[model samples]
Target chain A: MPSLFFTRLRQGQRTLPFPDAGPDLPERFRGLPIIDQSLCPSGCDACVEACPTDAIASDDSLAIDLGRCLFCSECSNACPQGAIQFSRQYQLAASRRADLVLKTGQSLQLAHRLADDLHRILGRSLKLRQVSAGGCNGCEADINVLNTVVFDLGRFGIQFVASPRHADGLLVTGPVTRNMSLALEKTYAAVPHPKIVIAVGACAIAGGPFREHPEVLNGAGAILAVDLFIPGCPPHPITILDGLLRLIGKIASPAAAHGEAP
Target chain B: MTISLPSFHNGEPISLASVPLLSIREFREEIIAAAGAGATLTALFGTPAESGRVRLFSVLGDPVAGGLAALSAEVDDAYPCLTVECPQAHWFEREIAEQWRIEPQGHPWLKPIRFQAPYRPPGRTWARLPGVTDFFAVRGPEVHEVAVGPVHAGIIEPGHFRFQCHGERVFHLEISLGYQHRGIEPALVGGPGKRTIHMIETLSGDTSIGHATAYCEAMEGLGGVAVPARAQALRAVALELERLANHTGDLAALAGDVGYLPTAAYCGRIRGDFLNLTAAICGSRFGRGMVRPGGVLFDVDPRLAADLTRRLDNALKDLEDAGRLMWDAPSVQARFQDTGAITAETCAALGLVGPAARACGVERDIRQDFPSGFFRFAQIPISRWSTGDVFARAWVRWLEIQRSGVFVREQLASLPHGAIQTPVGAPRPDHLVVVLTEGWRGAIAHVAITDPNGRFARYKVIDPSFRNWIGLAIAMREQQISDFPLCNKSFNLSYCGHDL
Candidate 1:
């Protein structure tokens, strides 16, 4: 055992490149939301009611505030929207909230019929800033791992930055407890325009199951227009990798919605 | 002739019947005898008595029903020490000495356990004086102390570990906790459907399920409410997921700490996957909201059921391969081996629980001994070893992970179908309920009373970290400075959990 100690001392810094090496993530991992208009229920707007961020709105048909939807999968479960299928493709880089929206009532008919769309990047790096609104620390744990050698997001032109001023993406976690509300809003406001807001935990999504409380803040959508919602109380690192890859346009489909998130 | 004191005036002992009162010296000897005979000392409950000092309520044995015992000791102003016999009484004695100034006589080690800032307000009667270890404070080769945290880099909880080290090797370690105390014990008096459960939920963010489970059991025990078998099975499944989530994350962290990148990342990913499954099943990645007082708050739908049963199968398999690589990986093994080795003797003396105890070869699991609800109907295996080192601990966690994954699968396959929760019946008053749970970290024992209004009269939670902190200090006995993180994580006792 003593001899074994000398040999084992130098095993640090072996990195597994994610995003750049771009490991093939699964289709079932909860990613963003896509609307299935046919399955959209009528007049039952529990999804809208359940949405903590007011990410979903209904007028005979539910319209997912793609920018607001936390992909917490709450709407997917409550939607007259069996309409919300968790999209498997992870690369969802968008400059506007409209890009994240899902229309449940045949609104995407022509858009769906169109050929595959590919957008060009301007060669700018994607910088991410994480703000924990009110998570139980699971998502933060996953985010920390993303910087590790295994899922080093830096390999994919995506970087985790220290400040909102340098970030193009926002990784907001937690269920938005009452105390974290001001900080959450201030953080979103600090990030410049053309930046995408990605709510990572179920707390930031549809407030997850902790929504049973009046004290819990719901998701970050109540404060800003969210671009991508990664459902799961704390999403898988690969699921996170999948989400990051999708934001960079490397993946063509978003992963499935969190089982219950809309 | 009976001597009646002012403090005891008319106060009744902790037990009226089924327990006989023993004089101070005789009681202390009986306790030592019982503890020496392998009767686990469950707790030492202290209450102000007629003796003008606090009386010790020593709960003894691993008997199916708890053993009740009490002893009355006169408060002594001189020679405040009692650790010579009952080693377990060291902390409790010091606590009593500091709080009420009653010294435990003839104790070998006497140190301050609480009231760190010292009794202030220019001192009052029965208050400990401004005291410091002047003997160790002197200059001759006095080990330079390195005070690390109540705040540290990284995301773990807060604890102040004072290291007495000579150069790179550690000589002594003193850990000061409770800085992050949120007064969870006092807050448990909130009425039913009150904010108390939620307060309990936040006691230890990671051990939410364990705390809530223990709370529910205490409620169940007091109310005599029989939860449906479906709820029992669901609780078991949730527990498995909770255990898997924490163990996997901790494993990944240990591998990462040892600088095994692939193993760390892979295990990290698997951890996320398992948490994803937890989120899928119960919505909260940590399974927090899933547990309520009467039963679970929600159910696992078919879609999640499929993902948990199928998709997770692959993740678990991949995780096993990753864990295998991590385990067999020579560097990871050496990184942990003997890094933070606690002696088996210390483990037995302290009566620690969970992986820390298991790593040190003292086998105890509340799930196995004091099974409640689902565990009463389940087979929760206890894995242990005698290496008393970090490597042994990490190995124990990994093995437990395998069993945990299997447990989830087994519970899911045999899941009884029904509503996740039933309407909680009104709590009854005047009942004392005690419930114990083996959390992701260790055993969490909850003791509470139903007030006349069916609300909590007094609720007390004893997290395993309280006992395991002793092991942590013992592990640092002769280790080097750099191995602090290894030792800390090996025990990984929660500061928030214990402080609460």
Candidate 2:
């Protein structure tokens, strides 16, 4: 018992104070992609060609889809003109599907707060059920990490319940494979009415890398109404937490509606 | 007498014509003979052949001799079952039957492994619904059956498990999976297209570094691309870090299953700490977008490398404390001691790999037995235990965690300096290569065959989960039904990797 106490003392206050002041991310971490269309060489489609998931547009404007993006740094690496760079902002979630698309000038459309009636019922204490239809476990791991002592998602009154019937919403991951399509439908149906849905990761949002495969139905959006879209190959845990916080009104919505105040 | 076949090393590309195409009887005889002599059946898959016939290919690994052997046979509609003589081929035969619309005549359990359309058109489809099939049952008034998942209660991937029980004791456990198939192998048939690496990276997300390394090695073998020393070193570092993270997480999970909260809570965070070290090297926590065909994409500067070593040391310090608490607790020990014991003989008979097999003292590790890439230069000794229970599994992981931590620190301390990547060209036509990596779970094998035009003719991935899930089932025999969660976590096999 003495040793246990000593060990606990050594561990000492590990949780981070986040949403107030963010932690320091690694310089190499690729969170959000910033596209400078003016620097694009004439008739050059290097970024588009280099994108494995075709997240970049072929048009002259160089629009990129954050939902489809794996955030692989392939675009940044392939661009000789240095038109594309990945910023260190891990807050990339949105309310609508089209809001995830980043054009050259516009800022990302962040997720809006829940409806007033629903917010009154669930804003303080929200319970969710996670369904991994075709996930590679990347998104699932990060979601699971939120329950750890460091993230301590329970502290925010957000918990992942065991039963869909007990949940206020469903957080779905993966590309929604054909084999799992039925089960996913049944799971979403089991949740209580007025339930919200959040699509996590590139696979759940826009099918990620397995988009055109015949076996996959692209993503969760094909069959369900997603209230929020969290984008990444598997979005970082903070990104997911940020999305959930914004959706439930735990974090205040930002003032800027578009590009970083020109 | 032993059978003679064309043999090669890990990641070595050999001509398709070199593997002797024997008759079905000869192929069966060769595999049985090899199994009797203690060679492991590493991979068994089927490719399309002429006149609507399916060509069955087998890769056997001689762990003792450090060599891999290959042979093939063409079968029309059905072939004699090899599972009766060699139980390891049971799952492989079922997979072949489902994928090629061929039957393994007289096999004990013939069911659709993955309920999906066959690779070739005009082939009849099996039961298309996943987990909608007859399960083996035990009948009596007192006997009851328990069914769980496809949608489990926890935040996890989908798969169904049925336990036939009499009161508290479980008679049998049947695991039905394939709810996560994305047709990854079939999608790779055209070329090494843009989406290939991404698919390989997610083949099983936890083993991203492991699978990515195997695919890259196979591609390099086919294209004859020479990866620089620095790139190979970095790949090894990432692979070991993956091992450290997963092993720690698994240890945490095992503790949680027994209702031990302290170790569970601490090790859970430490697992993330190891993942953060991986993120420090590249960007993603899971090591995605780091490995490529010819070499790695990210380079570790000296300062970053030093920082990683320091942080890794700090995490290891915390892990040691958590591990000690778990081991010292009597309640944890009582639950884990002899709950799910499988014999070493059963392990070899089933061809189990990774820490599950190592827990049985089998010494079947890809790195030690089939050293490729950086493993050829530096080595981590295989950690094993003899009891083959949940305790042994957890103990083996702890031993591995310490060893792998040491390996990462050493690699980071003296990283070889060179270019991170080199250009790799198109693959050679009519060539076949088999690559194996010792992933955190177990041995991961990828077999790639190129066509006349240098396009992928057949690409087969055999995840260790394919072989180990049955091990988890067998370990639960006669154990308390409630111990299912503990046993399942101890093995922690991948459903998507197996389904793919």
TM-score of each: 0.67, 0.99
| lDDT (Cα, tens digit) per residue for candidate 1, span B255-319 | 77777766667677677677667667654566656677678766666665666799668778777
Best by the lDDT measure: 2
lDDT of 2 by residue, B450-480 (tens): 9999889998898999999999999999999
What would the per-residue lDDT of candidate 1 be over residues A1-262, giving only the tens digit for each residue?
4323432343334465554565444333445566655566566667667664566766655566543443445556565547666665444333333544555532211011111232243123677777765455556676777775656667677777766777665777765644445555666677786666777755676564345344455677777677666654456566666666655555545333432333
Q: How well does candidate 1 score on lDDT at residue A72?
A: 48
Fnat by candidate, in order: 0.05, 0.84
The ten-residue window of minimal lDDT in model 2 chain A covers A253-262
Model 1 misplaced regions, further than 4 Å:
A1-262, B1-30, B45-58, B61-84, B92-142, B301-304, B417-419
- Please give the lDDT score at residue B12 for candidate 1: 15
* Candidate 2 lDDT for residue B8: 98
